[model samples]
Target: MQYRWGSAWGGQRLLGTENIEVAIINRGRPLRSVVLEIRGRSPNGLPPVRMFQEIEELPRNREVRFELASYEMPDEIEELNLSIVSSTAVE
Candidate 1:
């Protein structure tokens, strides 16, 4: 199955800023749920924060925006994109 992510606001602001709005999409198989883990390392020597979102009953080609507890991805990270389906075991 093919999957990808999209975002509206994908960066940090001054302070007390909100994270980027992201969406997860399954291009091939019919998915039931998805757990997205958003992590980032800051240049200010800040540790990475792992955030998660649960997507339920996702149809093919449909997308869901991830709600991260922390801020958007860092600027120093080597990459920024939707994570591949790590595990998509169907029920």
Candidate 2:
């Protein structure tokens, strides 16, 4: 899986104060279930903010847009890490 953060309209701006827009692409095999984790780190030395989303199903080479609700995102996140925590492939 691959992900990118940006507004739906354009540019690299965040969606809103309490929401994040992410575009995810499934480049590998079809999946029955998957858990995605996103970590946002700020430059001010605060603890990293973590968010998770569970995708029920993902087809190979398909793109999915997810608007994750974030209640404690820092105003200036310097770095973001997206990872696939777990996944189950379709048999």
Kindly give the number of clashing pairs for every candidate: 1, 0
lDDT of 1 by residue, 1-91 (tens): 3433223354444353444455556676766656555565555665664555577666777765555433344443323344444446465
In the order shown, the candidates' Cα RMSDs to the true structure are: 4.8, 2.4
Q: What would the TM-scores of all predictions be?
A: 0.55, 0.78
Clashing pairs in 2: none
lDDT of 2 at 49: 83
What local lDDT does model 2 show for residue 50?
89
Global CA lDDT of candidate 1, please?
0.51
Error of 2 at 89 (Å): 0.3
lDDT of 2 by residue, 6-64 (tens): 65455665634545678888898998688888888877788888888888988899888
